[model samples]
Target: MLDDTLKTQLKSYLERVTQPFEIVASLNDSESAREMQTLLQDIAAMSDMITLKTDGQDARKPSFSLQRTGTEMSLRFAAIPLGHEFTSLVLALLWVGGHPPKVEPEVIEQIQSLDGDYNFEVYMSLSCHNCPDVVQALSLMAVNNPRVRTVIIDGALYQDEVNAREIMAVPTVYLNGAEFGAGRMNVEEIVAKLDTGAAARDAVKLSAKAPYEVLIVGGGPAGAAAAVYAARKGIRTGVAAERFGGQVNDTLAIENYISVLETDGPKFAAALEAHVKAYDVDIMNLQRADQLVPATHEGGLIEVKLANGGVLKSKTVILSTGARWRNVNVPGEQEYKNKGVAYCPHCDGPLFKGKRVAVIGGGNSGVEAAIDLAGIVAHVTLLEFGDALRADAVLVNKLRSLPNVEIHTSAQTTELTGADGKLNGLNYVDRVSNEAHRIELEGVFVQIGLVPNTEWLKGVVELSKHGEIIVDARGQTSVPGVFAAGDVTTVPFKQIVIAAGDGAKAALGAFDHLMRMPA
Candidate 1:
């Protein structure tokens, strides 16, 4: 199961282990068990500090635990952590073996200071790009705090448990057998959820901070670029984001990003964060801005209010709060969300393996989702409200070649139908014929475009008909000293490169505005 290239990488990473650790595997007599044994043996052979033990009595086969020598610090994996989660597995090993993590000292302290025991069980899929963040977070907490325990379960491998818990989403987390959260979450976000007083404390600290010369909201490609450009100008730059990466976190593949041949969303997001961190930009993650207030006077500071009762004042503000996946908003869509209706095919496609599903929309994302689902699902029914597919010719041709896929143009999704707390089918209408129809399916993937994250800015700035912030060529909004960029703005293309360029333009525009202000 271990390839030569992977073995070399694993060996190099294991060299950072300062403490001896043992891999205790609980595997039964099965094909997967043999594969697991081989993988563990390959790992143990790389370092003398590592030992393999098969004495684990865990009921979950093909499961393993990494335990530090002469200590109780440990974490478990009930599935083979490969694909996107392979990095998570390596990080857990390094962390458990005494290699220091790359996190802020304060964050480490917070995790170690947690009061209660947290036994976290996270169900994930190998194809899910979002699962690694959550798995790595809980694993880091477990490695840091002996009171905390984490078990990363592969939903595909543990189908019985997944069905029993009615889990229909990837990276579905459970704490003490109760559902905690489902989706991409970092360590800081997890800590904030557990520590009841952390928000209030954070709010007080944030409110006391000095005003910034350039403050960027949201942490997608646009926000990151703006932060870099502003910090380069020797100005006080700050970024307050609900979560860094925004919609980019949900993206699976990116072959169009300039300068780079190919890369995934998480990798790109990480690089963006690292680049911004290299500058003087002060990044505040897990911070949500609910309101934006313009400056009253010519030189007054603009006030941005946070959801945690914290208000940040800035000399100039850059709004880059990127867009989110547009929902169908049809009946039963919300009620069956995660139960049958999912927006992210990359993360949730495996849940419907061998089951019939429908892909709503006929754009690039929708067509790509249908193609991706065709490989895993039994049958894919694609519905497009338009007369023809809006995807590129290449993608449309590829999708048409799939034998298990069917396309229906001029089809508008009317409602999602389900039974027993699960999605069972969906209703649609033939726009050209003015006739309604229904199709039976276990899952529905909504691939509609994006809705700008400018709802909070409503009544605050001039917006386009689609709710996008109207900006000039220099990226200045109607409100002076307030600039917008990326998907939230009136930019034509929502590509990453376009967003980055617009972000830089907005930063320069803000700087120009600052230069003209009275001292």
Candidate 2:
């Protein structure tokens, strides 16, 4: 049964349609095919414009095709359209109804100039805001040229493809049977890759001339705050990050940022980028800093080597590179990821509502997830690798107070078990008893400790035993002209507000150092 909330939204989306299209659904006798067929029928029945036509004569598997009422432009869908993909299916149907995407003239000309037939397959999730932009851009290319065809696949729906391509992220593109990069990308960048190949994507090189006074090496809240503060001082500033949003892009909800009631990761990240861009901060996104070359002489600029073959020089550098989630690399973990295995409880917990789920690792994050899931899920199981829980006593008491909560200490997760292309259960073992156990659950949240992204800075900067860069009170690193901030630094708490404050302090410290320099 479909959730009433989703049903209401789907109906509302279908009602606002400006045109009509036909949805030709075909099915086989297989179980998966039948299930997919039923899902399509249920959706098609919602609107008069949506038509379901079953073709058993030529049907090989559970598949459906979408074509305009009078046009030959048809797109094929070979999986069940559910979860975050529901949005993608909704948008695709609207586009089939004569709603052409807007495109730039230069992009159109580039697409029109292509000679050979090319099919651009974009793997995406409905929850990903970045996916819509790439999908729309490629859809424009496919519509503008007859030789080009683009298809957007929900990465969660096609489990086999996800396992085959090793797709760990959303909005991953596969060009002509080759794996392209992941992350949010612009239309011009995609076209550049398509026209001249991967080499063309890295054609824009960073210049070392006219070094900025302050350069922030991250794109999260910390880097954004730093850039804003530096730019406000009327000093040249630059922001370089592997991705503009950093770990904030992976988060779902934020309620404790001060003054903000509620906001999601993508929304907050967009606002941060917009705020930084409001100033004269030079944004060099999609660039990873590989090595940092400290300035040798006074007033001389430091050079930052990039992973994609470029060098950016700045008078002072602020390192705010954020931390990434430590994934539990057990069997079926990657295969069932985004299927039943998830890392961020905030981002994906709502998807598993009313279902039983488990939390791995007995840290503060696991206890918090158990408490949060207990309210939405049918049951919650907390598993810990240690003999005793590492969470605070208050959290332990609160968690024990929950009626549906269960805790297993010294439990080591062995494998994630799944069937029918979805996770169904989990297998683990007890360290003390030397016994094995299995639990029927739909979701697993890995909440192990976060690992700092400071391996690249080893030997270049002084680091703690855990690979975190050691920073003083003023955010100054062992290297004089370099500074560190955010989770990447020696900060105790890894909060958005804390990172923002650290970034601001780093920027001010850089400016202060610049002021004492002999001009």
Best lDDT among the predictions, by candidate number: 1
* Worst ten in a row by lDDT for model 1: 66-75
Tell me which residue pairs clash in candidate 1.
Answer: none
Candidate 2: regions farther than 4 A off:
1-148, 153-204, 329-342, 345-358, 367-381, 387-406, 413-444
lDDT (Cα, tens digit) per residue for candidate 1, span 1-519: 778999999999999999999999999998878888888889899988899999899988989999998878759999888888889988988998889999999999999999998999999999999999999999999999999999999999998998898888888999998999998899999999999999999999999999999999999999999999999999999999988887888888889998899999999999999999999988999999999999999999999999999999999999999899899888998899889889889999998889999999999999999999999999999999999999999999999999999999999889999999999999999999999999998999999899998889899999999999999999999998999999998889899999999999999999999999999
Segments of candidate 1 deviating more than 4 angstroms: none
Best-performing candidate as measured by TM-score: 1
TM-scores for every candidate against the unseen true structure: 0.99, 0.70
Give the alpha-carbon lDDT of every model: 0.93, 0.78
The lDDT, on a scale of 0 to 1, for candidate 2 is 0.78
Candidate 1, residue 512: CA error in Å? Answer: 0.7
Q: Write the per-residue lDDT of candidate 2 for residues 107-216, one digit (tens) a residue.
A: 66777787787777877765555565566566656655657666676655565676676554566777778876565675666766667743334524575346888988
